[model samples]
Target: MTKFFNSAMAALLISSTSIFAQVENDTEKPNSNPPISIETMAGSRGVMYQLIINKKFQSIPLGFFSVTNAAATWEKEMTPDIMTQAHLTYTLFKGLDISSGMQYTPVYGFRSVAGLIYSYVSPQMLIIVNPKVDLADDLAAESLALIEYRPKINDKLNFYSRLQGMYGFIPKSGIHNRSYIMLRAGLGYKEFAFGAASNIDWYGPIKHNENNFGVFVSALLF
Candidate 1:
């Protein structure tokens, strides 16, 4: 899996480089400020920090894109875990993108995967659907979804909430690999937000579960 993941990452990078070179002469200004979102959630369970990026290689085709989403967590009773997913995408149609990326977890180590992502994005609401399969041995499959809504309450504040979930399994044996659901709600002012948060995680085929509930503060940096 490690070897395959490295190869896939290299291939994607190389392909993207070539694509950018071909369009280097295009007469579009480069992006001045790439959008980046960062958040930190701490509770009775532990601390988790998340980073998300959606960037473009150029502006011509309007579909060339890159994404990096990652999270790291430290729990009181468990070993720290860091997971990352990155992929290059092209808009296949309205709100849909073909994705290929690397996924890392303590259980599976690293796996190269390919998948599709559908997104609905607006000022007040966001929805995403992502499903991918391992390109290496074991062929683990994973799916995830996230929904968020932040309606404007005034010029300086907004009501914020989000629900996110993910599940993974082995295709051949039909065994569950892992799953988790997380929820958050709060109020946002400028670049900071504070709210209540909860996380429920299940591990392995037996579905051993852990629960954490507490308050959280988060920040967004440009």
Candidate 2:
């Protein structure tokens, strides 16, 4: 099942790229919009297939073990081009969940990540702090802090918001500072979720280099 899903995701990405190329060729000049560029911009789309198997101990108030595998692809336009990461997450917890995972990418090598997530303040909010250690040369370790808030709006709908900040030891090539701000807003209905997010990256003294925003729609099959 995992193999099949991975193959399907690869095919989808190829098709999306082909379509983008055709559109670029058909148009003499591309629009100079935020997302649309005169030159072809690198982008990728893939299905994240995940499988989880877990067992909970009856004696403990909260004790569980689970295994999860996921695959994702990422691409950059002019600099730091194509890459893919696939990994499995092993989780263990008593009262609070502690997860450790490794992401392997052809270009970036393996990145080890450990995180602790806990919920408080009415159980509607979660705080996550993840420190990542990158094995690839020239890249340094980074820390990501995320605060997620989910509130039940009604029986049929809910709202979710996430704020994320990142700081890296070795700054990225093009960008000066490694700090960035991200905001996400989404609505969930049953198994369907739709969201849009914007990322503002700070670079140089002026703090203006590149900003990205995108929208996504997702559905859960099971």
Please report the candidate that would top TM-score against the real structure: 1
lDDT of each residue in 17-90, candidate 1, tens digit only: 00100111223344432345666677766776666665555655333333333333553455775667778776
Tell me the TM-score of each prediction against the true structure.
Answer: 0.76, 0.46
In model 1, the clashing pairs are: none
| Model 1 poorest 10 in a row by lDDT | 17-26
lDDT of 2 by residue, 62-150 (tens): 33322232323354334331222222323343213454455443444566644442222223554444445555556554454556566
